[model samples]
Target: MERLKLDVLGLCETRWSGEGHFASGDKLVISSGSPDGGYGGVAVVLSAAVKNSLLSYTPVSNRLLVVRIQATHVPITIIQVYAPTSSCAAEEIDDFYEKLQAVIDAMKSRQVCVVMGDFNAKLGLGRDFESGVGDYGLGQRNERGDMLAEFCRINGLVVCNTAFQHNLRSRYTWISPDGHTRNQIDYVMISKSWFSSVLDSRARPAAECDTDHHLVTMKLRTKHFRRVRCKSMAVRPFDVTRLRNPDVSEKYSVATENRFSLLQDRYNEECTPDELWDQIQAGITEVAEEVVGRRVRKKPPKPWISEEVIALAERKRIARCTGKDQEYNDLKLEVRRRIRCDRRK
Candidate 1:
């Protein structure tokens, strides 16, 4: 993902053991695995930039997975699927589409919805590709392709890759291992409401990967509303915990009482309810800050080490650098002893 500069990537047939998520260096992988069918699984890879936007993920089966991202202005729901091949029973394919349609139906209609991954359906271009398929599609429509096309029409989604014109190399996403057959079975479909926001969608056949399927990338023209600062973060919380002290509690009560008494005169004026509420909130916060003090967040104690041990270690470092072996050894012993004492306490 870092090399490709992709914010999100979908994987089909991941062959994972069970549903779980794990972090790999800078990327986060959310996998949905098949307990019974070891070969069938799906996953979504999120870059560090997109990880923070992740709202939730639901593993509908080994074949289907849904990931929701809270993107700036518009949230996004991505459904990744590894559709059953023709070799599978017809009932299984029907079940896959039924589960997929239910997931799409559950989503809000206005949000940006993207269904991507290996459909194993060659939605070939022709008379069958009209309602949702764009003019730049490749190949001839197969039975599975018909099912997918009808699914899109019902869900109001557009084949994003077909909406743009790309060369044959960039159009076909999969090539047979024998280097004989090439097809466009993988796709990126987006809701019709935000279809125009899709800047580009095509395959990168030249990209190197272990699989025969080329990487399918889609560029979206979405400027997520990034919040530089949060309103609550600006106001440092008062050390209300200090109220546990009897003297401190008395002081805080007196200070708050005085502040509220001063606000009484303003409340008598033609102040709106909003203004009154602001005055009350400001008075409490100000009194708390003045008497209780802003809460000082202390660093969590390091395992087996306290402030004393840390100071001892720093001295040992300086002594070692100054070639004081004896002092360094003494400090080292002291640090160990201090850690033991802290643990006992």
Candidate 2:
């Protein structure tokens, strides 16, 4: 969500088929759906921060998936779900929760689990206070809401948005296509232990994603974790060709020597194996960055397919658009001939 500048975003009802992860610009998308590519689906888009430190991900089914990323004190596990709609059968709903509970139980106790996305459940304000839900919820609790509440209580989670007081406009997450009815069915839930880290959570009605559901955002405070280069962001190799020059070779050698010696000086008996390995890797990388430098990526070149061929193709395109079938056909042939002649030359 570049418009909102979100680091992590949970999506529901994506309707995309299959399951996998892919890079979309600077962000990474992980999605899961039915094999037939229809009905409900869930996905998560992550920016470079969390994408870089990705630990693992599981595509449970079309309705659910899990993604884990390394964070400050502990790894953060995100479970994104597209729960069964209220109109769905009771058996389907029960099955969804059973699988969800299994997923939650599999997570480590030390990990910070964040369960979020469209639950299709309306958790409303109750008479007193609810364990998982807060008093500031909207509307009135329904059957689906009761089930969600019970699930959160069993898992020791708090519905983040319900804990905060917000106006109707910023509270409701979904609206009817006719713009009549509105409800707060989507939510961001997190473990009670990390509930304090949730600074704010609310539905952003201003976001224009052409969807009935508004974008839900949650602010969490955690120590800054350094981002590592992800697999998708492959690094270009150093320009080893420069080493052919005696001066350049000497410079690289001296820089590398200094780096290794500096690392050796800092080495301590108390340092673990991982620490020692990291130091050595960092030292080697620093030397390469300073002395060797990365090679400039080269673009594909087709000298034979020259400007003349491109101009001819443009002329053919114009002729076809002008409804001059004979002229267009002639020009197309001319373009092909020119290309062939250029290749021979």
Candidate 3:
């Protein structure tokens, strides 16, 4: 443990069960083993400071441990998971992310959620295999990247380690057990919505441990208390006409034409005007300071209001409050119908 210096160490496939003191002040909180699967178990070991903040911990599965801590009087739930190797079926990984999503959904919104462990998925940006001329060679497993991205989008989670940084070579966070090739497969994902209180997260190298995989650490600065703000207003009104002005239209056309010219020159293919516009929009959004494109909002529920509309809105709010996602959508449809009826009147 001293060699690792981890506040919380997640032994993915620990062979032993008993606890022992390490060079660092780490104590085993819980050790769980797979039913009949040898060489596959997970142990949660925490340092003195971490143990002092322990509120509760439970083993959700043989390969998973859920621990709750109160740091700085703030509550946070940390889940340690050990995923199967890369050779396993992608479906299995998808199921794992699904299960994890359910667990995260069950947690209270006020509580911060942090997941750390050997995900066995590249938290990397993939690069061209040989020359490395092309960017991006890490993160997720095959098509699992989109799946993981969707999961994060729905859950408002962020791979905290990769959220704000991406550098290659020395940036590779993991290496093969045989030390043949280097890759980053482990991750420390934080709930983007709730991790505002987190101070920092880092992954430590296990050079001295002589282990193939390294250790990940997260130092979260918790908030004393939490509160929910009252709902104020919906999205601001948008003006599509602003984008259709003569000056704006010419600029948009020129920008899009230039992008298509480059694409055509590279791919040696003709591109339609619409395709050129798409390429232009992509380039503008990619290099834009904002980084991400905003979804254009439709017109707000026809401004006109009526008694029936008010009643429908109330029902929709109740559905949302009661945690009935399907019912909430149905209520929204009904409310929209009423708005349309009122607008027609």
Provide the lDDT at 270 for model 3.
72
lDDT of each residue in 1-345, candidate 2, tens digit only: 554678888888888999999776567889998998878989999886667778789999999999988887789999999989878999999999999999999988979999999999988864334457876678988899889989998888988888887887778899997778999899999999999999999988666453678888889998536556677478888898989999999998898888888888988899999999998888888888888889999753434567878777767756755778788768867887887898788
| lDDT, model 1, position 133 | 86
Selected candidate, larger lDDT, 2 vs 3: 2
Clashes of 1: 2
Deviating ranges (above 4 Å) for candidate 1: 127-130, 225-345
TM-scores for candidates 1 onward, in order: 0.66, 0.67, 0.53
Q: Can you write out model 1's per-residue Cα lDDT over 1-345, one digit (the tens) per residue?
A: 655689999999989888979876567889999786569999999877887678789999999999988876778999999999889999999999999999988988778999999999988874334457887778888899889998988888889888788788788888896768999899999988888889999998645443679889999988543334578877778887899999999998988888888888657657888989998998887787778898887653334446677667668767755778688678877877887898797
Best by lDDT: 2
In candidate 3, which residue ranges exceed 4 Å CA deviation? 1-5, 15-26, 126-141, 164-170, 223-345
Ranking by lDDT: 2, 1, 3
Q: Rate the local accuracy (lDDT) of all candidates.
A: 0.83, 0.84, 0.61
In the range 1-345, model 3's lDDT, one tens digit per residue, is: 444455666667775443322322235346666656565577777665566566777666656778777755457788878777768787877677767777887899877788877776553464322211124335444554445556656766767655434344424567765557876666777776656655655455523232566555665555322222335334343343555578656666676667667766765347677877677676765433232224466442433568787777777766755777688678788878877887788
> What ranking emerges by TM-score with the best candidate at the front?
2, 1, 3
Better of 1 and 3 by TM-score: 1
> C-alpha displacement of 117 in model 2, angstroms?
0.9
lDDT of 3: 0.61
- Tell me the spans in candidate 2 whose CA falls farther than 4 Å from its real position: 127-130, 227-345
lDDT of 1 at 217: 90
